[model samples]
Target: MMNLDAVEQAGEQIWQTRKKMNYTTLGLTVAYTVQMLRDGEIYIPEYQGHIVWSDKKRMRLIESVLLGLPISEFFAVKIDEEKWELLDGVQRLTTLDAFLNNDIQLKNLERLSKCNGFRFSDFSALEQGKFESRGTRVVLLLENLRLETRLDLFMGINGLDKQATL
Candidate 1:
């Protein structure tokens, strides 16, 4: 049988943690976010590891954005008044960076097959403008949040689920 006292204590702890979470939701343009990444204002936590997204995966992300699909919200925690750390969405952010900066050649795309073999620079001005102006939703965790709480949130939200795609 389960220990009732232990269960009660765990429930109380969960309540306390939930009470302490403070966050805000905002939409930022793709160009703004990519610039933030380039300017080093947004940092990817070491726990996220390196970029593991393949070209096909990256291409699909770009295609989804071009198609105006609803992409997942990015989760980040404010490290200080001027800095922020990415807690989740590393793959998506890095993929955007790689594609927007023309670091990778996209191919084998199904929906946007016409974009095959094209880098960011090769896109028409209208297509590039559309991509740059796209809105991306983000969840910002305030700096008051404890590191342990941030990790717990990350694991609970992302570690248990398979990767999300549109």
Candidate 2:
């Protein structure tokens, strides 16, 4: 079991490592769109690919934005200085990805294009404003845990709801 200090140290180290990686899909164009769904990456044909965000979810996000709510959430992940991978909260991260790519249309927002495994990013100017205002957050946890740990974080945040991960 990890003590408080040890856990804190582990987390800090992970962040340091993550920063070192300096990950940003910013300019990287997506050669293919992969859906990080409940099963895994599923390539979607241009015509078939669609944002999974339902009306309710998109509406809630829009309302939160209109209300000036902050929606950044960190996903805790285990770390290995040599080889790092997601240890938890991959679903929310995946969802944010969908939003970033402009997959799900916000109340007034529209769908953009898709990127990577599952990122939608190609949108009408009007839609962009709506979702951008919603403001989603990504939280990454640093700890050397395994799939079990990742599952725990996913369930913890999802609350018994089986969420998708990209």
Candidate 3:
């Protein structure tokens, strides 16, 4: 069986390319989200789909893109309708999306020796100062995988905190 949890090899290059893309993925996702917003797509806030992300986690994800961090933690799944479903790390994705769209400005870091940030928008070079100076990384997985048992998987992915017995 494949170590679905083991970080994939392409993780590094994808992360590098993403940084080279200078928040390109984030930009695209943001634009898509914006269209959703304009289309009046509403996500229930009570779902806490509105969970607030902190500066530290945002920095880690930004750094994950900039530094070629491995794709160790989560699985990326392409849902039937083609939505990019993060099997885990919803909070992380939300944070990255928010920062990229300027719903929040990423905080603290210095310029990347590799790419010029200004040619872009929210990640304009000005924001590069906030990128994690080191230990940044992320890798994209190409596997079209769904858990053998989605209920167990969803509970596993979301955690057991909500399950309780009276």
Total clashes, candidate 3? 10
Off by over 4 Å in 3: 1-52, 71-86, 109-151, 164-166
lDDT of 1 by residue, 1-166 (tens): 6699999999999999777778899899888888888888888876567437776677889889988886789998888887788888888888888888898787888988987888999999998999888998889988656766666667676754324210
True-vs-predicted CA distance for residue 118, candidate 3, Å: 9.6
Tens digit of per-residue lDDT, candidate 3, span 1-166: 5464445646766787545321112212333443333443312222234345676666655656655454234334433344434444556546544555556544454445343232225454644443322221222233434443323444555664344200
lDDT against true structure, model 2 = 0.42
Instruction: List TM-score per model, in order.
Output: 0.84, 0.38, 0.40
At residue 164, candidate 3 shows an lDDT of: 28
Off by over 4 Å in 1: 1-12, 160-166
Alpha-carbon deviation at 97 in model 1, angstroms: 0.9
- Candidate 1, 41: how far from true, in Å? 1.1
Error of 3 at 164 (Å): 6.7
Clashes of 2: 23
Relative to the true structure, how large is the alpha-carbon lDDT of every model? Answer: 0.81, 0.42, 0.43
